[model samples]
Target chain A: MSKNDKKQQVETTGHEWDGIQEFNNPLPRWWVWVFYVTIGWGLWYTVAYPAWPLLTGATEGYKGFSTRGQVAADIAAVEAQNAPNNAALAASDLATLQTANPALYSYAVNAGGAVFRTNCVQCHGNEGMGATGYPTLSDDDWLWGGSVVDIAYTVSNGVRNESSPDARFSQMPAFGDILSNEEIANVVAYVRALSGQEADATAAAAGQQVFLDNCSACHGEDGKGDRMVGAPNLADALWLYGGDAATITQTVKNARFGVMPAWSEAFRDGGLTQAEVNAVAIYVHQLGGGE
Target chain B: MSQGDTPLYAAREPIFPKRVSGRFRNLKWGIMLFTLGIYYLTPWIRWDRGPEMPDQAVLVDLAGRRFFFFWIEIWPHEFYFVAGLLIMAGLGLFLFTSALGRVWCGYACPQTVWTDLFILVERWIEGDRNARLRLHRAKWSLNKLRLRLTKWVVWLLIGLATGGAWVFYFTDAPSLAVALVNGTAHPVAYTTMAILTASTFFFGGIAREQVCIYACPWPRIQAAMMDEDTITIGYRGWRGEPRGKASDPNAGDCIDCMACVNVCPMGIDIRDGQQMECITCGLCIDACDDIMTKMGRERGLVDYLALKDETREREGMKKTPIWRHVLRPRTIFYTALWSAFGLAMVFALFVRADIDITVAPVRNPTFVTMSDGSIRNTYDIRIRNKNGEAHKFVFSQTSTERLWLSVEGSEARVVEVPADQMLQVRVYITADAGSPAATAERTVLRFWVQDLESSERASADSYFTGKVR
Candidate 1:
């Protein structure tokens, strides 16, 4: 290598590594030209995009584009793509939601779940498991019916509320106005006995006749509450008001009719859209209770 | 003088590759036919995978996150199989390079085959090497213009076909082909085709040998992969050193004929020591052998030989079989690595699950205290059904005997997924009141989704969080 270099007399950087001299070389013209093109591209990129920091904000490039705007556009595109499915979900019945198209059903359920977390969970308890006076929606029983349309109607109109004029209406007629306090207590015992709860057998035996004569008109002869009048079944362990003797006595004295606010656009407080209403209704129905 | 005293870039000298017929040429023709045939026809072959799945025998379904190759189907979660195949490919390249240097670049590389075809078209239109040289040197004329235009158009059509065959691997070939013809395909498809066509035309036609010489990094790096035992085209310098014209009595076997130089695609003289630009194509050896046969001398004036063999010949040793040079430790190591990757990938492909499930707990308000004093948590369960048929899966949770699994609006606690699709369902698992697991602050809940019609099952575990109070 030294013999050849002596003959060629090529200039070097005068640096040697392991007897090999370093020849100072210039960048290839093609490489230099490409490097210039890249620098030009970089300048153009900064001018055409949001760049350069300022005291207030970055300089808005000529395009005036921001990642925020891009994200918003992306979101809008997704929503637009799903608009028809959303519309179908809004109009679909529960069977169609559950069976015909699981994708749409899944959309409604997820949307409904979100709605539940925001609004309905406050009254219906977490996971729609109602507390005390509020109904346990996760049960297999319902005051009216657990069907999807029934749940939709109930969610939209509410129960005996001022928001919807078509709200579920029923009155126990305040039987205490006619019967004595002792009579109310005896009827409570019989109602508890029908649901297989511990009760005074003697008082229950006497209350059975009283129940047949007066209460059976709406409560039925067997003490199973009627659905037409929006009455609850006394034969079930589930109690809308309560199963306790004291609570039943109080309910008989002045009827228990809990009110749920209307959640439809036809009601107050900037009610939900039809889609949102359907979502919450679907959510509640899926809470292990819909028949 | 400064290093910049001389120009940094040298202009490309034209290479007029004269046509030669030999065993190597026939082998190159056979290889090009096989590889190009596979590239263009693989997408059109149909493999029935039932109704809801794509039938393309070899497809990379990017949107669907699937790769289908005949009897094998790969999902995104099983991407290690693809990785394994790529590893195998890398090892295979190493194995072949150790045995025969730059064999891939010579006959099988897309660059070599496509450039050869484009050159063939040019020669057919403009005549052979001398005719082309003459035509290029001549002033522009109607005849020259017509031939140039005709050759370039053919080249462009070949480029278009090359690009057209590539897009079919990503979608249903017949439908995509129709859509491409009608301009109804996705804009990206057209953009990809245009870019590919442009690159093929520019690289295979205009760039030609310049790409192998200046642009490609392989020729620069491939020297590192070779050892002295690796077979390459070599000129028998010992026998051919004393050279002259055919009429000179002092001349050795090799006359001063430049047939080897003219026939070289790279336009480099093989008589010089090996250089980085050599692709080991053996065409120069073929050219010299024909000349040697005509001169009534030995046919191996330039031939495929290893450096070790050359050394042995210098030491007056007898020739050894080719296998003695090929079956060395480096080739054996590469072959072993290639086999390991291939075997591992095949095993993984067979054992991979067609159905997979993943459950993630909703962390915002992670646990909900039910009215009955039990704690409940919801999960987003994503089910990927890779099978060709739809399936109904029963989802059940474990970690507590009293825990109940209920799907959204589904009283049956089962989920249904379409063939080759993913379905995400919101699931609620509620612990029973007064249960030990419900009262615990945290517990791992395992949710198993089982196929109703098959024995396939996949399970995912998530933490079921609750407050101790």
Candidate 2:
């Protein structure tokens, strides 16, 4: 507390807080050395890498690094790396593509997924579950076979359309003009009974003869419906339309014929290329049900 | 000595640690040689891990995302083994530090070893302590410049080797060396070498003990890790206090020869008492012991002594055994933890799966209604084959009687996953009219993949998304 006990004042920055004076001390030797080293490093970095800005353009340092150039190089490298896989995919048969090279198969599946989202999702639902009257693409039940090549063919030519000359064109006769309403009802009941739907036994018995005579040409015996003609099997539990008495009667009266657009480049509406058609076919075929 | 004229930030007082012949010095020499030998030669050793994998005994394949060590190969997912090893190393340092104070820094640390090597080269070219100090005070001459240039060139060569050895661990050593000579190696390799070389030369040659005193945080943190029982080199103040000339018979055992001060690498006087800068290499003890023997006095004026034992000796009690200092609670704890971590990592390595299967159900539309009226669900199946040999697996599913499963592109129910690759295949599963899951909106489907040769099976469960019929 005595004035004599007070230490001699050192050089200060002329500032004091709570009686504590700030001393004008020099930096430590190691700290100064470290600062000098960083300054040297900064000078070297400016000389060796893209750094300072000028009036017209920035100075390209010795390395001449650029973000755009790096990106272009990276993209080029990736494309070069994938060129072999693309070639393999182009050469392989559509049916064997999945098993031949898994790398290319994955690439096709991924690329096909994108094409399916853009072109095929409208009628087939988002995941190809299919709305009413539209065939479910994800299922194993294929009216024209679920083989990859078969799907590819169907995708290329389409069905029941005048657009493609090679299209699968088969139509059921609308017996409404030839037969009476009673005969149409009987046939409907028989078809419903074949698929194990509730139906009138007497009516089904009488309708069997009419079906054998009129529909057996395309639907075949036992009503299995021949794949050669793309006729759906009536004996199975599946139906394109409702299987009720009224719905089937309407179907037989009108003769349901759903039309799919040909994805081949030969068709209109900006049809896909052969590669794209193959991609979408592979996509739809592999959605859990491609045979 | 006037306070007003003294510099707050003093210039570095250069150190020239005199040569000493003692057991600790010999131990240091052996450790340095062994460590440097292993570091420089490890990348050159080769081990055949079959034709599919790299042959280098120790390699860090950064591009391939694999680490190869002798017979063991580590994938990216197995990085926990590396983490465990790092934890064990940390605990090992703790264990050693609790028993022997700063022994890692004293002998085995890269900083200490490299600095010692640099100093050895400096003494070889310029001469020993007195001669080097004299040369420093003298004016610049052709002889001095020649000696200095030779020393720097040798130092630079050592730095180059150190940097070169580091980069070799990440690549095939011989091929990389050839590429380096041909200027065909990756620029990153050369840049890394330049950075490392510069740092090694600067820290080992110029910075030296300054790093331990100023830059490194270990000395500050380790003070809390030590206790009174930990062994550290210290001057026996009781025996050597009031340090008087040897002619005075009343003086303590210490002759005040200043031998310990002349030989200290840290430029500290041991007689000043215990300080943070001591690495505990025990060279001062050897120098002082030589002086003691020449004067016909008892040795250990400056020696590896525990603070507690020193206090006890001052109180006229018998010094306890060295084992008592080493065998204590913290050291035992650290040792036990380090061992436990090592054991756990080993156990994990043995039980790791060689085959893994994962299934992801397509959830966009979930299920589609087939023409045959069967409910179908799509699942993406990924099978990973971790083995070196190629293998085929039987693909099957567990479900009700009406459910049938098949891999994409084939109805054979067999799939092949190549060696060290993942095969992603879309699997279509159809559930017939009477299946139980057909009526449920969603259900867990178990898909199995069994190796044809080993019968080792792996299964994955995914929700089979469907609609109620």
Task: Residues B62-170, candidate 1: write the lDDT tens digits.
Answer: 9978999998988877788888887787777777877888898888888999988888888899988899989989999999999999988998889889989999999
Docking class of 1: incorrect
The number of residue pairs in model 2 that clash at the backbone is 1
User: Listing every candidate in turn, what is its Cα RMSD in Å to the true structure after a full C-alpha superposition?
Assistant: 8.4, 7.1
Clashes per candidate, residues 3 or more apart or on different chains: 0, 1
lDDT of 2: 0.83
TM-score of 2: 0.79
| Weakest 10 consecutive residues of candidate 2 chain B by summed lDDT | B1-10
- Highest DockQ among the candidates is held by which one? 2
Residues A172-210, candidate 2, lDDT per residue (tens digit)?
A: 888888778888888888888888888999999999988
Which candidate number has the best TM-score? 2
Which residue pairs show collisions in model 2?
Answer: A288-B428
TM-scores of all predicted structures: 0.75, 0.79
Stretches > 4 Å off in candidate 1: A1-83, A94-96, A110-263, A267-271, A287-291, B1-4, B362-366, B396-412, B425-430, B442-447, B460-467
